[model samples]
Target: MDYTATLNSMGQGLCYALVSILFIFLAKKLDDWRTKNFDDDRHIDDGNLAVGLRRAGLYLGIAIGMIGALSGESAGFRTDMLYLLVDGVLITGCLFFSRFINDFVMMGNMNNDRECVKVFILGDGRTVTGNTALGTVEAGMYIATGFILNGSMSGSGGSFVQSLGSALLFFVLGQFVLLGFGLVYEMITPFNLRDEIKQNNPAAGIALAGILIALGIILKASLSGPFTGWVNDIVGFFVYTLFGMILLIGFNALVDRFLLPTTNIATEIKEDKNVAAMVLVQATIIAVALIIAHAI
Candidate 1:
């Protein structure tokens, strides 16, 4: 064992850690412009530590993903550092653009806005306003997006220009598939997602979060296949994404009937604000995702 090589590698790891932390700080700033209803200052002022911590988790996830993508190919220190910065910036930009599309184009502010605290009208006609699960959902989405895109971009060894093109293509196609899934979810559900979330329904938020993560898992699996042409790869991703959606829907239907026979998840979430039920719903979604991820 060469001590010199070992020490050098340790130093490099420390440097990467420092730079990754910096990138996380910068990524959070970049995401700030697109994030809605997640006012950091307000949350902090109101002593809502959960919201603040979730935001950190989201940004850190993005940074870590970018760092992982930028690493693994041996190169000079300066060149690697430059690539890391560029990868972080580009990935962050892609995420921000996706959020813009989801918020402005897809949601259209019709879902009653994505605020942390929402007013819920109970069955007894009582209006209760308080913090909701959107914060957790938002954080989950960012982390899931990072996981998907990072996994897609990894190991596609190429020049900066080639890598950038692939990243852009994957990002656009992935967002498109995700939007389609959202529409399908809306169609199958009994109530409007936006309205439910606006009513401070954490159950809705959890379900959506689970779907996003599941899709990300699906996308990662689809993209990790053999390197084919751009057209073939994109088309293949769409097909796999659809299959994943079907699997998710089917699993949910079965669970709704069999897993907890007495509990109607949707009603419990919408009318009862059953946080435990919501957590179970999320767990089911993620469990399916993990199973698919492993199978793929």
Candidate 2:
């Protein structure tokens, strides 16, 4: 309706566009340096879909991390730009290095970086390319942590240093829950969780990735908004995650009963490697998580 206002918006959009390009480029160059014993760009050039997905996820993660800084309370165009650039660089540095922590912690004994880029030779004169399972899971880690960081970097209650402390604390807390959830999930599920993922079973990996992403969404809610004392907030986070975990497990149970009463989901996924079934599982998990997140 207002031509002058529209023109100003367009001008600002162009600035954001340029910054976005530069931010992503900077993240890629940082990845090149941070990734150890692995060459993501070379593998991507060699047509590895797994590597491509991981790299894509990293970019998307960077964007998500920037969203809070971009949209939060603005001090003016210049201040907003300052926050955007600062947050972009911070997100890149944190997430790039966090990849190593995730590879070691959440992945257990498996080396995800190596797994994604490793070549395989089969006994029947056939070669398996890359491990899509590890790739997808690693991507999930990036995207999920992005949401977590977004929450940490949000709100107007604390100083920047304090926010950093809260972010680090939340990140560590999220990791412990994730690790515990994996163990609990393994105990309840019929299939060998680690074995399936290690074997490059796409279905298993998808399920695991779905859980992590869903957990991230739910945790983001806990970390959002103003600080209400550290003890209360941390307790609230644990409570929210506890409820979310129950719902995640219960939803899977319901799916087993109502969705696939005759067929065992474990069998379909582990034995048959039914990606469709896993897709259903993944969708259900995220759908439940979304509901829980909004309700919280």
Candidate 3:
């Protein structure tokens, strides 16, 4: 092993650690402002530390991936540092844009305390309200998008302006994919997602969450970076992404038809509020995502 090379790597790792902390702090401040204005619940207020950490963790993950992608073997500390700051800020913006789409376009945060029924009240009036795990699955959606975006931006090799354009285009493309998925989900269901969530329907929330995460998992492969300078490279990227998403949808439909012929997932979720059935759907979605991701 080369001692000098090892030392240099360690130094770069330290810089990454410091920058990650800064990114998380900045994201939290923005999240705080969002909570204050929009009535978005803070994970801390509900004592769900996992949710809080997951949000910050996604930011850190994106920053690290971006830095690694941009910092070539020959790049020095200063060049890498510059890449880190610029990419970090852009990725953070991506995070914010995702939040906007979820809240406004998807109506994710439509109602909190206003329409939510205490879980205990629905049952035997026990003291313990069951964990709805509300907001958790949606948060997973953000994290999955982060992973995809990070991969897409890697090895971009373009000028900063070109990279920025590419990143923005990819972001819009990602949102459209998500939107298309949500619309399909809504069409299949009797009840609207926002209304279901508002009424404290855990089944609806969990299944939707699974769908988003699974789509992200499969899409990550399509976003695998190192894009070339050729115009065909850009065209191929979009084509592959659409192909992956469509294939996943078809695969999911087959699973529903063949794996559980008698079961109606949407009705079970909307009418029965069957958490176990929802879990089964979630599991299938994840299983498919894992298989596809591995194949890719």
Index of the highest-TM-score prediction: 2
- Sorted by lDDT (best first), the order is 2, 1, 3
> Which regions of candidate 3 are displaced past 4 Å?
37-74, 108-134, 229-234, 257-264
If scored against the real structure, what TM-score would every candidate get? 0.84, 0.89, 0.78
User: Model 3 lDDT vs. the true structure?
Assistant: 0.64
User: What ranges in model 1 sit over 4 Å off?
Assistant: 30-39, 49-57, 110-114, 117-133
> What does the lDDT come to for candidate 2?
0.78
How well does candidate 3 score on lDDT at residue 77?
79
Residue 196, model 3: lDDT of: 72
Where does candidate 1 have its weakest 10-residue lDDT segment? 108-117
Q: lDDT of model 1 at residue 118?
A: 49
Residue 133 miss distance in model 2 (angstroms): 0.8
lDDT tens digits, residues 188-213, model 1?
Answer: 88878767755556677777767777
Query: Could you give candidate 2's per-residue lDDT for residues 222-266 as a string of tens digits?
Result: 778787778987898899889878888888788777777778778
**Clashes per prediction?**
0, 0, 0
Global Cα RMSD, each model: 3.4, 2.4, 4.0
TM-score of 2: 0.89
- Please provide, for model 3 over 81-146, each residue's C-alpha lDDT reduced to its tens digit, 9 standing for 90 to 100: 776788778888887777667656665554322222234345555442323434544465576677
- Which pairs in model 2 have colliding backbones? none
